[model samples]
Target: MALSGEDAGETIDIVEPAVRMGSYLAEVQPVEDAAGLIFLLWAIQQPTIARPNAFVRQSSMELRLDACGHQITIVQTPSSMSNPGVTGAVMWDSGIVLTKFLESAVDSGRLVLQGSKVVELGSGCGLVGCAAALLGARVVLTDLPDRLKLLKKNVEVNVKERNARGSAEVCELNWGDDLDAELTEPPPDFVVGSDVVYSEAAVVDLLSTLRQLSASCTTIFLAGELRNDAVLEYFLEAAMEDFLIGHVDQSQWHPDYRSQRVAILVLVKK
Candidate 1:
């Protein structure tokens, strides 16, 4: 992608486990060091799932990056290596966890796409929020403490001044945690989520948090990747009580990965 004011390979690579990895050199605009930018090269190469099974035990390769302008020289993991999660960076630093469903929801224009005052929940690497901000939406990239740190840096690093003058913000947001106090300011006009619901317990907290944020007449849009039939069932059961579910289906972003179809649900005043 061409980052404005930056040429190709402007990214700064953070270290991953693999050696003999690829590298690149490019020009990058200065950015705030404390900004929550996820390190350029951290992917949850471990099955891309939470649980680790026999396959999980196998070694996994990690990606290395060198940013130049907005272009990055990324080295895909070789087939031989495994286990890139040694740094705990993968969980929150991975890119495009569920781009297919996310893009679908955003492109649909079904919700109140004010393109202003938006907050994202469980914004792992903040890709979705970044995309929203790119669409002229002022967005907040939020997750846990550690994750927020990197995410904030990413916003400063990746976003150009031309994009709403870098209107994106990053903060700590934990589901099942405070939804009110967590919002640094007044209620946002819109709230978005992606791949936040998969577990039984997470679904409860996710819905509870979504419900809490649902008030204020703020329209909310969520795109999730259900791992299995059970998780899908739980999503329906929990969401049915609070949200008006809409469009659901399976889709893919790239030919390599296909995120399961999702049901779009909008929070209505109860």
Candidate 2:
């Protein structure tokens, strides 16, 4: 078969690996034999360029997780790598752990989800907030403006069909910004975030946002991946100055889903 519209000799030489292997044989070749070498080069080189892109175009995937006997369906981007800078694009292990913990807590009567006003910070994929809405809490899932689209889509798909007792809303919440006038009137009774403490620079802003929404009776739950020791340590140290922080034992979560790398911390306004 024809390799390129270009000359066969030039094409064969351009394929470095084929040329090296065929160099000795080429010395003995008649003019007609060059076409055989050209075909071999074509066969080897086509796959390298013809292969489809490994990363799929941006799209949402539906994932099913059973929490508190309720099957939660969350729609989110398949891979964070597909869209960088949007940590909120995918569901994380910390979010799963937190969601399971919330389900268990509500079922055991340790927490009151019913009628409680809840706000979630950096609600990546909106899994934790959707779980809260499933459990009967009036939930607001907040993220940076750029992240709101995916977060809202997840909330819509997961929370709407459940016919949940509580309603779910999506809003913009930039940590450290003045609490929006609407978010202030009825201060949230509970503040929750999953895997939100990834950056040292954002810790102060996160804490400020938490402090703004918190009152004496408000409780905050922050679930984070223990991947970075320094970042986690810095958050705890800085947050201790303003809030009483305590770790929730893994034993408190569903046995099957417990993980050493995931931590859920409860913070009360001090």
Candidate 3:
């Protein structure tokens, strides 16, 4: 079955019978009422037991950026849930929301990406980084060592193949580790991340890396799914020690992409 919406202007094919309705809902949570109802009705009609050989191991997600008028395709591994250690294998809603927010921010002249230097932390699937590059910012996509293979592939396919106005290079970045001179030579114009804050332990390291990457003029934009209030609060409290932090109101987000479960924050070093 296929589902499409006016706002999204894209058709999604429902092909995995083995997947439960809840699984589909989790994949596209915070969907509009119309789409949610459609998914519900479709789920009601599927058989209880999925047929054999129905699983698709890989998929591609497409994000169309209106600001740059480019369609970015990101290849994702379908078993992110099973491989919890490699959460970066798939694209998350927070990443999607952040990418669209960047596009909107650029279009409205609220943010300038053209010719700016950008660094993306935890660049899962390289979605946000590639979007920034397409918007004309030179970007470095950084993640843990294992995630680089897929991250590099997505960057190559979306940014390099398309010949984006700006450029993107994939690099390995472990939180709390010393950053290479090239990454912090003059400090980036912007440091962006999505879904990077998850655990209390990682918050300290994340902030350490953020401090290392930021300059007085650097702007940091982080988008995250509001799953754990305690963790988020911990990150916010720790982050405020060295930076002036503010939330990007939902009013400023892309209209169709707004979600109560997602938050975008703007930070700058003190």
Candidate 4:
């Protein structure tokens, strides 16, 4: 629940509201495998759902994450009951981890962000995409059309007017649907997503989109909270058939913020 960076001045603490408890149940104790991990996360979440809260139509918050000497500021919409299913409006811990990972990878020269064409799927609140743009990648942040309003606003505030080599743009992208024409012709060099794998149905859709967009040269990164073992297992099983997938080492990320409840995966065409 704490995102600490390299410097003493760089640490940023985020306090999750009672209404947003569903998204903040991370950092649990490690379990044996994916199944046990998922069950433990599920068990932790059951009681929090029984609470109640007032409706918040709209509000904004600023979040700062420091990693690899880079301080990234994100403008986001905090969780609200008015728009129940619009998960993209809020900032989740998995997104924070992935954003920091991108910065760390770029700083370590393990990944290239400068002048790369990058695409972010399920870019809720656009934090990860904004981080990518700040690292000099031309980033396209995509989500369902209904989610684009808030997603676009976040991108506009955080990523606009930057002198970074790459700029951020918002686009409509429904997983499992036909690939958008603009996205296919150039094929992004890198694809990324955070906290996107949650349901069995969405796993199928997400894999289909990845297949359509990826080639032998493309690299994909996905970060997800280990909140559902069955859903996570389904995605890994299906993705392994077409793309080589492996868990990213926790040592590669900032030590202060890494959590066993979250995972980052690297994927490439087989």
**lDDT (Cα atoms) of all candidates against the true structure:** 0.46, 0.70, 0.73, 0.68
1-270 in candidate 1: lDDT tens per residue? 212222265644322221110010111222122111112101211223543221112223332222211221122223312444222233221234333333344445432333557788887555556656655667877887756665665566555433332267887777877665546356666777765655676788777777776655565655543235466555655676655443221232322333223233334334
Worst 10 residues of 4 by lDDT: 17-26
* Residue-by-residue lDDT tens digits, candidate 4, 1-270: 322222345532222221211111112222123433233334433423432211112255766666334455656566543675767776777787788777776766677788988899999778889888888888899998878887777777666854555689999998999998677779888899988888887888888999998876678888877666778877777777877655555777656557666777777767
Per-residue alpha-carbon lDDT of candidate 3 for residues 192-270, written as tens digits (9 for 90 to 100): 9998999998999999999999987688888877666667767777876887655555677888776655667777787
Candidate no. 4 TM-score: 0.75
**Cα misplacement distance, residue 72 of candidate 2 (Å):** 1.6
1 versus 3: better TM-score goes to = 3
lDDT of 2: 0.70
> Candidates ranked by TM-score, best first?
3, 4, 2, 1
Q: What would the per-residue lDDT of candidate 2 be over residues 45-155, giving only the tens digit for each residue?
A: 332343231211225476678774567777766666466666667677778878888887777666778888899999877888988888888988898888888887877
Off by over 4 Å in 2: 1-60
